[model samples]
Target: MGNEDAVRDSLLIRGGFATLLSFLLGSTMWSATHPDDGSAQLVFLSSLAFGLVAAYGLTRPTMMSLPKRATWMLILTVLWAVLAFQEPTAHYMIVALFALYLYRLPLWWGVAATAVVMLLGSGIGVVVMGSDVSVVVGPVMAGLVAIAVAVIVEEVFMVGEDRRELIDELIFTRSQLAESEREAGVVAERQRVAHEIHDTVAQGLSSIQMLLYAAERDIPDDSPARDRIEVARKVAAENLRDTRAIIAALQPRALQGGTLADALRRLATASHENVPGLSVEVTVGHRSDSGALALGTLEVSLPIMVKSVLLRIAQSAMANVRHHSGATTAQITVVADLSAGLVEMEVIDDGRGFDVPGALVGASGRAQGGHIGLMTMRQRAASIGGTVEFGSAPGRGTVVRTSAPLEGHRLESQHP
Candidate 1:
């Protein structure tokens, strides 16, 4: 049952018990004042004691184990049977018990218990009070009515619960569909940007470099202007390489036919080749020894867009290490923590680092030029519900840690 239904039932049961106890008290007082038999005082005292115990039982928590509730019900039945023998009016308490049973137990068990109570009450009325055989009729009708009411209540609550579940399911499905559409739009935009850079910026740089090289060759072999042309050609060549790298960053081709682990390994190899005297190592697996996930858990479970974001961040971090960090050895570590629903990549280098805050501030940070890459890494992580943290100081080693939620994760907070 829902929480509200359980609360309402609790109130109704307590109120019903109060009403029955009041009735029993009144009947006991009248019987005692009239002095019907020597047992009048005994019956009055017993009724008061039974009322107290039942009231205390009603105060227990509404939600109880089946065995405990059954035991309580059995005790109440025995007490009610004894009182019915002493006072005929006590037989009416059976109606209250029947309602309680119907509300708490299964339908068939409630009906059976109701039958037993009616039979026991009727026997007491006819034998102890000397009433007619028709004494069974009133209790039987009351029990049946209580059963019908209980069944109707159960049906109403079941329908409400089913409707609530359907509404919740629709809300969840709508949110997931919206996320899927947003992801698709982001991918399409990235591809368009990559294509634009390839067709315009990269192509223009290539033409400029080729023209400069040809012009340099035509000049006299030792002419002073020939050295200047060579320098310009080299500058154009470097710019062309930078442009191509930007295109690759916008849309990573390394992830096309490989998993994230393979992509990282290739990136490390390329970084080692690009920077002389720098050795880069890639490690992909769990961080702990116990409860290790499968080697390809991330590749099989993570979305392609998320994997691309991680690879781009790793590439940017590695670029910083090779170009600026001046480190001899670097480590690229990827850890999948299934329990936390997060995958983290850390790039650590024993290189000369700079002031993080100083490099991330306003125009001054932008003036540094290299800090632009750090901001780009942060933006990329934010786009995919991830975070990037830099740990470094001047003359100290640098560590870049990036984390993103795995597929199907619902993080409480997306930012740190």
Candidate 2:
């Protein structure tokens, strides 16, 4: 059950239980102590009447009518006290105090009612029953006791209400915290993706532009070098196509055919064929149906911020492959496991590798900024609820790996 309903149910149950217990205790006490007195009979009847009245008042649906109820209950309690004075009885005064406690009447009203009832009941006992021995002290003691019980019950109820309000506030705060964290994660991811795109794809396109511009000036129209320029021109055009794809992938597509696998294959083919001397090979592992669903769902369902980040990561990786990797051959791998809800992608190059620390934190002597590629890649992965890592040394080639949790998305048939 919801928290608010549970609290209300508990309050009602306890209130009913307390009322019942009080009634039974008072009836049993009066029966045992004053069995012979005719006044005891009247006291018993009055207690019964008060119990019924109090029960009705306590359980009624009048939370919004509390002020009206309190005023009426106060007036009734006063009238009952005056009647007890004319024909005094122990049960009459007890019932009045019980009413005060149950309704949470004002302290002045409660004190005054208890005092007046006790004084009148004691005076009648002294005059009619000739019970003077205890009359002086007994009524005063009962009044004090009634007031104390009412105060304690009031305090307990107030504390309970305060605690319940606190719990509700805490629940609201927790919900807000969860939402804030999710938004922050999305924002952080986007920053990383943007950085990657700037470093990788942007840089690659710039280099290609420079290469073609330099070639245009050196080669004659009829020369074989001119053919080389044409090849470079085609490579630049193909690279532009891949760049456009990266942009499209970043956009939100309700339903685009071809799984993540197909997209990666197309990327690898375009990269290898477009870059004249480069050979790009892509491999796909046996994927679970669930993993495919998760990846596809992510592609289709992710918030715009997350999608943008992933696209930026892809663009950055391709850019790095073109510019930094001197190797003629490169490899891209894509793997997914549905049951595990895992999706992984890796880009490996057999190119010259540098110190990881130096690349991230530029060397002391070098004037230019350090390698931002790894940083951007890592950020992008983390933003999409994933992680990225790079493995490399001075002589060894570099490997960039990224992994993320997959949410299910329906896969559509690939178009030719």
lDDT of 2 by residue, 77-191 (tens): 6544443543444333454454443445456666776677667656766774576667656766777777787678667767776676556545544564465456456554554
Put down candidate 1 lDDT per residue, 166-251, tens digits, no spaces: 56645554564465457546765776686677678888888898898889889999899999988888888888888766755664
Tell me the spans in candidate 1 whose CA falls farther than 4 Å from its real position.
Answer: 1-5, 8-13, 24-35, 106-108, 129-133, 251-416
Off by over 4 Å in 2: 1-64, 75-79, 82-88, 91-99, 106-133, 157-175, 222-416
Error of 2 at 304 (Å): 14
Question: Where does candidate 1 have its weakest 10-residue lDDT segment?
Answer: 407-416
For residue 22, what is the lDDT in candidate 1?
A: 75
Please list all clashing residue pairs in model 1, or write none if there are none.
none
Output the number of the lDDT-best candidate.
1
TM-score of 1: 0.57
lDDT of 1 at 52: 71
